[model samples]
Target: MKNTIILSILLLIFIFNTEAQKSAEVISIGEKVTFFSKTLNEERRIWIYVPDQTSFQKKIEKRYPVLYLLDGESQFYSTVGLVQQLSQANLNSILPEMIIVGIENTNRYRDLTPKVNSTPFITFLEKELFQYVDEKYRTAPYKLLVGHSLGGLLTIDILTNKPEMFNAYIAIDPSMWYADEQFLNQTISQLPKQKLTDRKLFVGIANSLPPNVTLKNVSKDKSSETRHIRSILKLGDFFSKQPNKGIQYKQNFYENENHNSAPLLTQYDGLRFVFDFYQSDLSEKDFQDSTSLIVTKLRNHYQKVSKGLGYSVAPEEEFINYIAYDALGKKHFSKAKSLFILNLENFPQSNKTHAAYADYLAATGDIANATEFYEKSLQIKDDKAVQQRLLTLTSKGMTLTESDLIQYVGQYVLDDYKITIVLELKDGKLISKVPGQADSEFVPVSKDVFTVKDKQGYNITFHKTNDTITGFTSVQPNGIFKATKKS
Candidate 1:
C-alpha cells in the first residue's frame, strides 16, 4: 500500500511538471589530454580547457598563460567556472585568460607523497606534462599551480625542490602532518635557500578544530584531528618569518570552513593574490579628471604588468573600447580619440575595433576617414551593423519616409522559386511576412536599403531602372534572391 501510494504521487507530480519531458543536454567541460611520462613509464590523462577559438579568425597567433590544477577530477569544473566568470570582459576581469590544465590522478598515494621518495613525479611534471601542454596549446612562459590536501602536499615538494617549474603556487589545507611532519621541515629548510625572485605563494589554512575548541586554545588540546591544522600552522609560522622579500607569500585562515570546504574560497583568493595587477577598474573621475592622461595611465599600467609577467602584455581590446565608448558618450572627444587610436594600434586587425574607431571618426566630423575605416572593417569581416553604418554614411541626404515605405508593401514573387515574399507597413515600419515564418521588421539605413532587426535576413536592396521600382534583392543566408512586384 505504501509503494502504491508513493507511485501514485510520483505519477501525479510528473503529470503536473511542465519540464518533465525535456531531456538533459550533455555538456562537454573540456578536452582530455593524455600525457605519457617517460621517466615513470606511465600514461596519464589530463583535462585541459583551451580557449574556444573555432569562430575566431587567426587564432594561431594568440597565446595565454597556463594554470595547472592538481587533483583534477575533483576540482576541474569549479576552477574552470571561476576562470570563465572572472576573466570575462564585463565581469570581474581580475585575471587574464589562462589555459587551465587539470592533472587527473591515476594513483594518489605513490605520486603525491613525500615519504615514498617518489621524486619521479617531479620528472613527470617538468618534462612530460609541462612540455605536452606548451606544445599542444598556445601558452605563455608564466605558469601557476593550485593543489589541495594531498595535492597541496605535492605542491610543497615541487616548490621546494623544483622551484622553477611554475611562477606561482597555491597550497590549500595540505596534509603537513604526514610521516611526523617531515614535509614541514623540508619547507623550512628549503625556502631559505631558494631565491624567490618573482615567485608567489598563497597558503589556505582551514579550521578543522574539534567542537567548542577555539583556534587560540586548540594548540593545548592535542587531538588526532587537530594534528593536521597544527602542522599547517607551523608551516605558516615559517612562511611568516621567511626573510626573503623576493618571494611573495600570504596565508589566509578560514575559521568557519574545514579541510574539504576551504578550496573554493582558497582558489579565488589565491588567484587574486597572485595576479593583483591584472584588474583595471577605473572610476569616472579618473577619465574625467584629465582627458589626456587617462590613456597614458592605462599604457603605463599594462607596461608594468608585462614586466612582472615576463611577457609583453597588451591591454584587452574590450576594456579599452569600454573606456573609449564611455568617453565618447560624455562628449570628451580628445580622450575618446586617444583611447580608440591606442586600441587600433594594439589590435588593428580586430573587426569590432575597426568599427568602433569608424564610429568615433564619423562622430568627430571625419566622414572621409570614417568611410575608409568602415571599408577596411568590411574587408576584414562583413557585419550587418558595420554594413548599415557604411550605407548610412554613403547614402547622405536620402532619408526614407512613411510614404516611401508604402511603395514596397505589395506581394513579391520570384519566378525561379515558388516562394512568395509579402511586405506590410505597420506603425511606420516595413515588416516582412512569409508563410510559416515569423514577422521581421526592416530598419531603414538608406532610402532603398534596409536591414532587418532581430537577426532576420540581411539587407534588402531595391532595384530601379530609369526611376521605376521593379524588384528587390533579398539577401538570405543561403544566397541572394530577386523578386519582382506581383500586383
Candidate 2:
C-alpha cells in the first residue's frame, strides 16, 4: 500500500507537469498604448489593463471602473496583478474588476509638480486622458487615482484644487515639504471647506525617520532627513482633528517600509478601504435557513454598495447562481426560486443565469418551465451539456430508476490502455474514479448516458445486451473509446 501511494503521487506530479508544459505560452498582463496629448502638446505612452470580457458568461457588454496610476512604467504590472487577484481569483469579489491606466512620465518635475499655482499635468489629465480613456474603453463613471512621492504631492494637489476629477485618491508618502510646505498648507486649509461628499482618500506614510528618531521625538527634530515624515505626520494629525467636510479618509504608517517598498502594500490597503462595501458576507446559516431573508438582505446590500460606487450595482450572476443552487441542494425550494428569479432579472442575457434557473426548476419537478429555461439558455450559447440534458428530458426510455442505475455501477477496464474505472452509487449520484486521478461525479442525463460534472463535452454511455450490462464508452471531444465491464 505504501509503494502504491508513492507511485500514485509520482504519477500525479508527472501528469501535472505535462499539462503545464502544454499550456506554456507568452502570458501578457497589459498593453502599452501611445496617443498624442493635445493638452501637453506631446506624445504620451500609457499602460492599460482591461479585464477580459470573453471570460464572463454575460452576453451583454460589461463596463468597468478605471484606476489611473502615476509612474506607469514602474507601477503598472503590480497594480494590474493586484486588481485581478482581488476581483477575479477564487471568487474573492473583494473589489470590482477595474481598468488600470498607468501614465508613463516624460519629466517627473515638469509633469508631477505644480509650478506657481499652474497645474499643466492636471489640465492634461482632465482634458486629454479622461476623454481618451472614456472614448476608447467601456468605462463606468467611477475613477480612482494613485501616486507616490512627488506623484503623491500631485495627487494631494488634485484633491484640494480639483476634487471632482477622481472619486478616490491614494497618496503614498507624498513630498509635502515641496516649496516650503506650500501645497501641504493649502491642502490643510482648503479641505475643511470643500464638501467632498462620497469621495475617499488614503494616505500611506513610510518610515523616513533616522535610526535614533521615533514618532514622539520626530516632530521636534525637524531636520531635512526627517522633514518628509514630519510633514506627512502633521497632515495626518490635522485630518484626525479637523472635520474634513464629507470625504472618507484613512491613513497607515508602515514602520519598517521605506518610500520605495511602501506603495504596493499601501495600494492594497487603500483599495480595500475605498471599496469595503463591495463584498457582502453571507454566512452558511443564511444558506441553510429558508426564512433567513437572504434575497432581501442581498438587495439591500447591493443597493448600499451602488450608492457608494455611484452606479447601479447588481449582485454578480455567478454569485447569485451559486447561492441559488446551494438553497436548491438543501431542499429550500422557495428560497432557491426567489434567488434564481432575482439572478435572471439582474442578468437577463447571461447563459449561466438561465441554465441555473433551469436547474432549480428541474429539481423542483417543474419539467415544462425547466425545459423552457434550458432552451432559452441554449439560444444564447451552444452548450453541449444543456443540449444533452434537454435531449434526455424529452427522450423516452432515458429516465432510470435507482435499481437501473445500480446495474451500471461496477468495475470496467480498457485492456489496450490498461486503465480501470470504478463506478459507484453515492447518495443517489454516480461517481467515477480512475487510478491517479480525482473522483468525478456524474450527472445523469439519460438511463444510459451520464455527463461528468465540470468536465465539458465529456460523457459516459453504458451499453447493454440481453437485459444485462455489457460495457460503457467514454465519449470525449477527441473521440469515443470503449471499456469492457469487469463485474
Candidate 3:
C-alpha cells in the first residue's frame, strides 16, 4: 500500500510538472553564442569571456590575446576563473589579460581525431571561426590553443602540422596510443620538418597505469591497459633528444595525479612556461640607483617580450603615469620627466597621457607647455576635469612666478579651529603639511592664490600689508576659515 501511494504521488507530480514549468525562471551565468558554419554544414556554439571595460582603465580601449580552449562545456568556467585570478587579483599580474574562447564540441570522435579526418574542423576554425571573432572583437595577433585527452591529441597534431595556427599550444594528458601510434609516429616525423621559431608547446603527462605499475618497470610490461602511458613516455623522450627546432617545449610528469585530475594544474603550469618572458621584477636598489636605468630596463624587458610575442608591446601607459606622479611627488624631477616623456611617445593618442603630462608641467610651473598639452587633451576628449584645469590656467592673474611663490612660505595657525598648517618650498614647489596628516601640495594659480593639488574645491589666498606676508584665508566646501602667519 505504501509503494502504491508513492507511485501515485510521483505520477501526479510528473503530470503537473509540464504546467508548472510555464512559470520557471531562466538562470544565465555567462554568454553563449552560435553561428552556422558552412565548412561543416552545421551550427556551432562557443563560450567567450572578455575583460570588462573598466578592467584596465576608463575610456581606454585595449586589445588582448586570445586563448582558444577545447571541451568548452566542461572547461569554460574554470579556465575563465583561472585567467581572472592570475591576472587581476591581489596586485598580481602574473599573466597578461586575455580573451578566452571555448569551443563546444558537437562530436568528440568526429571532430577531435585525425583518424576521422578532422581536416574540416580545422578548416572551420581557420576560415569561419577566426574571421568571425576577429570581425566582432578587439583581438591581438598572438593566439594560444589548449586541449585535453583526445583534444590534446588534436593539439599536438596542430603543432606538428599547422605550427603557425597558434603561438603557443598546451596538450594535457593526450591519448597517444590512438590508432596504434600512427599520430605519435607522424608527429615525431613531422616535428623536424616544421620551423617552430617563436612558438611554444607544453605537454602534461598523467599517471594512467595500475596501482602496482611504476615508471621503472611499466615499460617492460606491455599491456593494452598500459599502452597510453608508454606512448606518452615515448613522445616525451623524443622531445628530450630531438635537435632544437626553435620551439620552446616543456613536458611535465604528474606522478601523483591521474588522467582525470590533471588538466587544472597542467593549464596553470603551461601558461606560466609559455609566458615566462612576460613577468618582470625590480629591486629596491634598482629604483634607488638611477631613474634612467629603470626606464632602460623596462624598455629592454618589453623588447624581449615583443620579440617573443611577434608584435610590438609597449609598457602600459598607466604604469608609467603612476611612477611619473610618484617621482614628481618625491621631488625626483629628472625621473618624472623621463617617465612622462616615455608615455607621450608610447601613447600619443591617449587623452590621459596628454592630461598627465599637462599635470606634471603645471606642477613644475611650466605654464606654456602645460597650457598646450591641456588644450591638446581637450581636443581629443572633452573631460570636465581637464577643461576646468585649462580654464583655471587661462584665467587672468592666474600665473605666478617662482619668486612670487617663495614669499608665502611660512608657518600658520588657525586659532579658532585649533589647526596648524606648515608651508615649505621644495624643488621650487610649495608643500603644505599638517601634524598627523599626509602632506598636501599647493599649486600656484595666481599671485598669492593657490589650490591644493589633487583635492577639489579647496583653495588658499594670502593677504599682505605693505608688501609683508601677514595671514591667509582657506576656502573649502564646508566653510571658509582663516589662518594667521606665525613665521
Candidate 4:
C-alpha cells in the first residue's frame, strides 16, 4: 500500500508536469522586488500582487487591470488581501480581479510634492515602471492610481496635468492642503476643461477633528485640525459639480476615521464603488428562471459590462454552471440543455465542461452523444473518477483498431433493472454509455475478457460467439450485473 501510494503520487506529479500548462504559480500575497529604474536612475524595491490564474483549460489567454497603490512597504499586504478577497468567485464580484502594483517610496516628499517638478518620478512611473509592468505582466490598457495623504496630493497633480495617465483615481484623505492648497486649486481649474470621457475619480475624506469637535462643527472651524478635512470636502464639492465631460465620480466621508486610519475603510469602499459593475448579482429566483429570459438577461448584463471594461466579458463559468444545474434540478430540461450546450460551446476544451454536457445528455437519454463527449473529455485530460464512473457502471493501453471494436458495439439491456446500455465505435475506439450516465472508453485487457479502461481494475467479461458478441457483464463496485445484446 505504501509503495502503491508513493507510485501514485509520482505518477500524479509526472502527469501534472506534463499536462498542465506552464506558468508561474499564483501568488496569494505578493513578491517583493528590487527593480532598476531608468527614469529615476535608481534601484527600487516594489511589491507586486497578481490575481490567481484561471484554470488552464478555461482560457487560452487573459489579462487584468493594474492598480498602482502608493506606499507599498506599509500597505502592500492589506491592499493585496483586499483585492484577493473581493475578487474571489464565491465572494462579492463588485471588483474585477486586478494586479496590485505596490510602489515603495524611497523619497516620499520628493516625489509626491506639488512644489517640485517631480517629472522624473512621474516619468519613472508613466514610462519606466508602467511600461515594465505592462510588458512583463498580463495587464489590460486601463490603469487606476490609489494614494493616501501626500500620495493623494500627487494623485491630484497627475489627474489635473496628465489626465490620460490613468483611467481612474482614488484619493484617500489626500493632503489637498499641500503647498498651501496649490494642487487643489489646480484640480479645480483644470477638471472642467478636460475631456474626461471614460475616466472616474473617487475621493475618501477622513475626519480630522480635535477633541469636542464634530463633522458639522469642523467645517466652521478655522483651526489647523480641520484643515485636511476641510480641503478634501471642498475638492469633493468641486468635483461633484463638474460638467458631464463623460467622467464617473463619487466621494465618501468616513466620519469615524482620521488620516492614519482612513485608508483601511476607504480602500475597501473605493474599490467597491469604482468597479461596482464588475460583479454579477444572480438571485436564487434568477437561477430558477427558464432558459430564454434568464440567458438573455445574463448576456445583456455582460454585454454592458464588456462595453464598460473595453473588453468582451462573459458570465462567469461557475455562475453559468450553477444556473444550469439549478435548472436541471428543477426539471427544467429545456433550460438545462440550452445552458449546457452554450457552456460546452464556450469552453469545449474543458474536461469539466465535457463531463457536464455528457451528464446532461446521458440523463436526458442521449447516451450515444454523452459517451462521445465523455471520451473527448478523457482524451483531453485523464480523470480517474470519470473512468471509474464510466466503468464501475468505464485509457492508456495497447491501441485497438476500429474493426477490432466493432464486435463490442451493440445495445445490451441489464436483467434486473432492464436498463439499456449503449456501446459505440467511434474514431477507432469502443465506448460505453450506461443509462442516464456518462460515457466511458474501453481498454482491450484481453480478447473476450477485456477489462474496462481507466477503471482502476473494473472489467467487463463478454460472452462471445465466433466474432459476434452476445452480451457482457458490468464489473462495478456495487455488484456484477449481466446484460444480453438487444440488437
Best by TM-score: 3
Per-model tally of clashing residue pairs: 0, 0, 0, 3
Residue pairs clashing in model 3 are none
In order of appearance, the predictions have TM-scores of 0.69, 0.72, 0.75, 0.69
Candidate 1 lDDT over 195-285, as tens digits, reads: 6789999999998888888778777878897899988888888878777758898989998888899999999999999999887766667
Q: Which stretches of candidate 4 lie over 4 Å from their true place?
A: 1-28, 53-62, 115-118, 210-225, 289-292, 375-487
Q: Assess candidate 4 and give its TM-score to the true structure.
A: 0.69
Worst 10 residues of 2 by lDDT: 53-62
Worst 10 residues of 3 by lDDT: 51-60
* Prediction RMSDs, each to the true structure: 12.2, 16.0, 13.0, 14.0
Which lDDT values do the candidates have, in the order given? 0.81, 0.85, 0.83, 0.77
Error of 2 at 408 (Å): 42
User: Residue by residue across 339-405, what tens digits does model 2's lDDT show?
Assistant: 9999888989888889888888777665545656777788789898988876665432235666767
RMSD (CA, angstroms), candidate 1: 12.2
Window of ten residues with lowest summed lDDT in model 4: 52-61
Q: How far is candidate 3 from the true structure (C-alpha RMSD, Å)?
A: 13.0
How many clashing residue pairs are found in candidate 2? 0
